[model samples]
Target: MAHVLVVEDDRPTAEAIASELRAHGYSVDTAGTGADALALAQAATPDALTLDRLLPDTDGLALLAKLREVGIHAPVLMVSALGDVDQRIAGLRAGGDDYLIKPFAPSELAVRIEVLLRRTRPEAETVLQIGRVRIDRIRREAQVAGEPVRLLQMEFKLLEFLMRHAGATVSRRMLFEQVWNYHFDPGANLINVHIARLRRKLDMPGEPSAIVTVKGEGYRFDAV
Candidate 1:
């Protein structure tokens, strides 16, 4: 579950993009105004961004410069109607990670985001960190604030699940299928009980809470 920052001025379009990303277990933060979009981009701590070319307050290219100036180097997939090669080159010069024309498939948007995430991930860092929590995939180790955590088999799988989807809400059904590999009845409440226990260890007021429950949905990793 990746955290995505979406900067689109149109509300309907923003909602559509957010919904599509959420369906695949991505946590998305959207802004309609360029000022707000820049602010959100600075705070989103995203693994990527979906930005529109035309913005209300400022052009998207300028915002891209602002993002780089502030040191937010997350991969970005720019949304533009400009099809000219020179315009695309300008976008790249402005620090856009990728560009897409308007009137494109929602599925295509998702694909581009994934490609950037895969390509931009550093090869030397197999271990991922979100704040103080760390996951060492090769060693099968998860540490909390630098301390070794002793987890049951199920807990390890649950951590792995959240780590894979670091930001998006993973519905109960998806969790059941992917993490448990058990698509049992919807009546099953095992996920909730385990989640509560994990919360006690991870997010008890003074500590950081890596897991966030998305109300009617399921859960997400919120490590900013």
Candidate 2:
């Protein structure tokens, strides 16, 4: 899965973008300031970045230059309220792969980041594997222990999301948003029912379920 760093000072906007990216299966890290963003980028380079054009401490262009100096050459999608042609050009000239004007749809932002990632990493993996399970994204197939596993459309999507986030806790709300495309929780056992069916198919007799429930929080997919 692709990893993206979101650098935006606006708390609500940052959270909204981060949530949207996470729902789309990209691991995301958020920073409210330039210093924090630089620190995060240095510690663990992201595949791409969604940088706010106007940060509180420094101009986005300056931060971009700093990142380059430190050898972090990830593509950047600059987000700004300045939608004027001149401002957009400046952002592009400053190493922004793309510029998104404010008031834009979060879905569109995700797509733009995806496009950037594609351009930079054309060979991104299409198949996902964890332990004995494997899934081909292009062929829409799943296997456990080298044997085929039949799955309905919805079940495949759920499994894909879980596999992409292997070893991480996935919230029920996240599953609902990403898998079911539902913005609000239905307040039902819809996810539980589907997951139970999936567990039965993927689990071998006398083996533990791959998906583990984290009481009061959500489910964690054990990589093992």
Candidate 3:
């Protein structure tokens, strides 16, 4: 069963969230303070974390920054009563994989958690193949058709992420978090620039492109 750490200062609310997750067959740990959450995260890194924007000891974003500084990359769902656009941007800018406002149903929270867990789960296969492109994760190499493709380090990471999700839509923010490991947007078209570079290397003559843009959503790697 997947484990989740719930960081909420309110005892009743925390327990309620834990119970709901438990009902869904997930093992959960609750922390009422940032310190406890940090300790638990270090000791037994949970598959995912549901963090409250406000904690008793410190700001949740501060704790999240600390976790990221120390190399904890587990998906985090930041919950806050502040539902404004700026607040949501702040949460995501602080390294959260997703953000949810308060007054939400437990079922909605559970569904969001499920998606985060699904995105972070490791794949069993070492070799990933999509269309005529093949990625050898173990060797850190990629090949197109019968030819070798030289990819930069970042390019390789980007390809691996897209291939792992195959047909799933991956937002630019998601790519920034997972690949760059930074929460805040780079304030430019850096992701697009990188994607263009990868596309140039991956596209072959007379072949359909492997990457597709989901209009208004994100990018998806064709499963074919």
Computed on alpha carbons, the lDDT of every model, listed in order, comes to: 0.78, 0.87, 0.85
* Pairs clashing within candidate 3: 131-224
Q: In candidate 2, what residue range of length 10 has the lowest lDDT sum?
A: 165-174
Worst 10 residues of 3 by lDDT: 103-112
Give candidate 1 misplaced runs (Cα > 4 Å).
Answer: 122-224
Summarize candidate 3's per-residue lDDT along 1-224 as a digit string, tens digits.
99999999999989889998897789999999999999999999899999999897899999999988877789999999987889989898889989877866665576568769977775578898888889999899999886899999999999988887676677776678778976567898888888889889998778767888877667888854
Can you give the TM-score per candidate against the true fold? Answer: 0.54, 0.56, 0.56
Which prediction has the highest lDDT against the true structure?
2
lDDT (Cα, 0-100) at 210 in candidate 3: 88
**RMSD, candidate 3, Å:** 7.6
Ranking by lDDT: 2, 3, 1
**What lDDT score goes with residue 73 in model 2?**
97
Residue 68 displacement (Å), model 3: 19
* TM value for model 3: 0.56
Ranking by TM-score: 2, 3, 1
Error of 1 at 180 (Å): 38
